[model samples]
Target: MTLDALKIPETPVCAAALEVAVAYCSPALLNHSVRAYIWAAAYGEAQGIAFDPELLYVGSMFHDIALMPEFDNHTAGFDVASGHVAWVFGAGAGWPVTRRRRLVEVVISHMLDSVDVAADPEGHLLERSTSMDISGRHMDDFSAPFKAEVLRRYPRLGIAEEFLACFRDQAVRKPDSSPAASLRDNIAERILANQLDRTG
Candidate 1:
C-alpha cells in the first residue's frame, strides 16, 4: 500500500517526532524510510496484527538519524542514522521507557540484524524467507550474549514477534539497492521528473 493510504496518526507529537528524525537524516534516506514504514504497516494489517501506524511511522522515520561522520566511516549511512534516531526521538518522546527502548532497538536492528542482501548479486530480488528468518531471529536472539552491549546500554527494550514480522517483511521486500543508493536514485528521478514536467 502507498504511504498515503496508511492511517498514520495525525497528532502533533507524532509529527514532531517525525520532523526531528527527518531533520537529522538525508532526504533520500528519509524517503526510503517512509516507503519501508508504509510497506511494513500494510503487511501488518494484512496479517491481522495490531500495529500502531503512528508508532511505526515514527520508528521508521527516526530509524537512521544518527549519522555522525566519525562513527559511520565504512558503515552504511543508515547505521549512522540509527544512533541519532534513538537519542533524539527516544529521549524526546517521553514514551513509556520500555516502548522508547524497543523503538530504538527496532530502528537499529531492523536492517542489520534482519535481511541479508549481501549474498544476492542483484539488489532487487525479494527473498521473503531469508528476511522472515532474520526478523524472527532478531526478536528471539536480541538478548543473546553478542548483543549484550546494546542491551546494557538500552536496558528497557525488547522486540515483539509481531513487530519483528512487520519489519522483516519490509526489509525482505525493499528494493535491492542499499537504502543509501535507493534514496539517491529516487532523488535523481524526482529531480529529472520535475525538470521534465517544467519543460514539457
Candidate 2:
C-alpha cells in the first residue's frame, strides 16, 4: 500500500511545490491538502488508473491557496486564483506549456461538479478526493481500513472550522462569487457548531 506505484516525478519539483504550499497555507489547510493527495492517489489505485503523481500532488497542494486571505486576488473565484498561482509557478520552473496548463486545469476543475477524466484524469481524481475530504461525499467509495490508515497518518486537525472561516472570508469579499453563493447557508450551521463545541 505504498504510494510508489503512482510514479511521482522528480524529487526537486515535488519538494519545491510542497515547500511553497506549506509556507503559504495554515496547518489545518496544509494537512487537508496532503490528505487530498493521498486520498486521490488511493482512489486512482482502486480504479487501476494511472495518474501523473507530480501533477496530482502539486495541484492538490495548492488547489485552495486562493482561499488564504493574504493571497486572495479578489478579481476571480478562489479556484481561478489558485490556478493562476500554480500556472505562474510552473511557468517559472520552465515546465512545458501543455503540462503547465494541465496542472492549472487540475486545480481549477476540482470546483466543478463534473470533469472529463479522459481529458484531465488528475482533475477528476482530485475532485473525488476533495469531495470526500471536505463534505464526506462518496465516503463509501473507500474501505474502512483505508480510511482508518489515511486518517491515522494525517489527522484532520480541526480543518472544518478553519476552512469555514476562509470560505466565509471569500464569500464576504465578493457576495456574487461562487463561494458566497454556495457557502451562505453553511455560515449559520458552522457558527452553531462552534457555539455548541464551546458549551460542551
Candidate 3:
C-alpha cells in the first residue's frame, strides 16, 4: 500500500522512537527499517489483520537496533539484543510493561521464519514485512504498482547490499549469533549473486 493510503501513526513517542533509531543505525538500515514499517502496515491491511499503529511503527523502526553499538549485547543473539534495545526505548517512552513485552516479541520475532499471528498480530506483521523488504520474500502479495510506489517514496539506495554486508559481518564477528546459525544461506547466496534471494 502507498503511504498516501496507509494510516501512519505519528504519536509523539513514535516520532521520538524513530528519531532515536535513525541516530543509532546506518542510512541503509534506517531506510530499510522505515520500509519495513510501511510494508507491515500494508500487509496488515491486505490480510485484514488488526494491529496497533504505534506499536507496529515503533517496533519496525527499532527492530534491528541490536546491530548498533549501543544496543549490541556481545553474547546475546541479535534478536534478543534488539528486543532489549526496544524494551529500554519503550520504557523511556512511558510504555507499560505489557506493551513493552509485546514490543520485545514484535522486534525479536521478525527474524523467525514464521510466527503465530493469533497470539501477536503486531509481531507477525513485522515478521512478514521484514522478510518482504530484506529478501523480497512476499513481493507477490504486494502488486507491482504498490511496490513501485513504495520504492519511489523510499529509494533502496543499495539497502540489499548494505544490509547483507551488515548481516555477513555480524556472522563473522559473532559466529554463534542468530544470524550465523539461521541466515548463513541468505548471506552466501546474496553475496555470490549480488542480489537478495527471490525465493522464500
Candidate 4:
C-alpha cells in the first residue's frame, strides 16, 4: 500500500511532536522515528487492533529523543528520560493527567520485550514496531509493497550505525540501563543484520 492510502495522524499535537523530533534528532534518527509510527499504525490496521493514533505518533516521535545529548539523561535509561519528556510534552499539549501518564507508559513500554495488546494497545504496537525497525523483528508480517512505500517516504540513512553508537554510549554511562542489557544480548549484530537497512 502507498502512503496515500494510509491514515497518518495529523493532529496539532502530532504535528508539534514531529517538529520537535525533526528539530532535535539527526536526519537518520528522524526518519527512523517516522518509519516506526508508520509501521505500527499500518500493522495495527492490518491486524484490526484499535489504537490511539495521536498517542502512538507522539510516543514514537519522542521515544528516541533522550538519545540526543540535549535530552539525554546520565542517570536514567533513555527510555525513562524519553518518557519524562513525553509526559511534559503531553502536559504542554493540554492532555489530561491520565492521558499524559498513558503517554509515558507507551514510551517506556516500547523498550520492553513485550506489551500485552489487551492491556495497552499503543504500547504493544510501539514495542513491536520499534523492534521491527531496529532489529527486523516481525518483518514478515507486513507486505513487501507496504514496506517499500514506507522506505520510500522515510529512507533509512545509516541509522543502524548511528543508533548503535548512541546505545553504546548509553550503555557505558548507565551500565544498569536497558541499553546495556541490549548490548550484552548482541544488539549490535541484530541492528546490523536488520533487513530494512539493506532494503533502504
Query: Which candidate tops TM-score?
Result: 4
lDDT of each: 0.43, 0.78, 0.80, 0.93
lDDT of 3 by residue, 123-176 (tens): 998988887777666667677777777777777777777767667767877898
How high is each candidate's TM-score? 0.48, 0.86, 0.90, 0.98
What is the model-wide C-alpha lDDT for candidate 2?
Answer: 0.78
What is the per-residue lDDT of model 4 for residues 59-130, given as tens digits with 9 covering 90 to 100? Answer: 999999999999999799999999999999999999999999999999999999999999999999999999
TM-score of 2: 0.86
Give one digit per residue, the lDDT tens place, for model 2 in 1-200.
64444344566778888898888888878888988888888888888877888899999888998888767987688888999999988987779999999999999888777777788889999998887777566677776666766666667777777777777777787787666765754543533353212211
For model 2, the superposed segments whose C-alpha errors exceed 4 Å read 1-10, 184-200
Please tell me which model should have the higher lDDT, number 2 or number 3.
3
lDDT order of candidates, best first?
Answer: 4, 3, 2, 1
What is the clash count of model 3? 0
Q: How many residue pairs clash in each candidate at the backbone level?
A: 8, 0, 0, 0
Q: Residue pairs in steric clash, candidate 1? A: 64-81, 65-81, 66-80, 66-81, 66-84, 67-80, 123-176, 124-176
- TM accuracy, model 1: 0.48
Off by over 4 Å in 4: none
Candidate 2, residue 66: Cα displacement in angstroms equals: 1.4
Q: For model 1, where is the 10-residue window of minimal lDDT?
A: 121-130
Mind sharing the TM-score for model 3?
A: 0.90
Top candidate by lDDT? 4
For candidate 1, write residues 37-122 as lDDT tens digits: 54455455544555556556666666545432322324334443464555555667677777666565555555442433343211
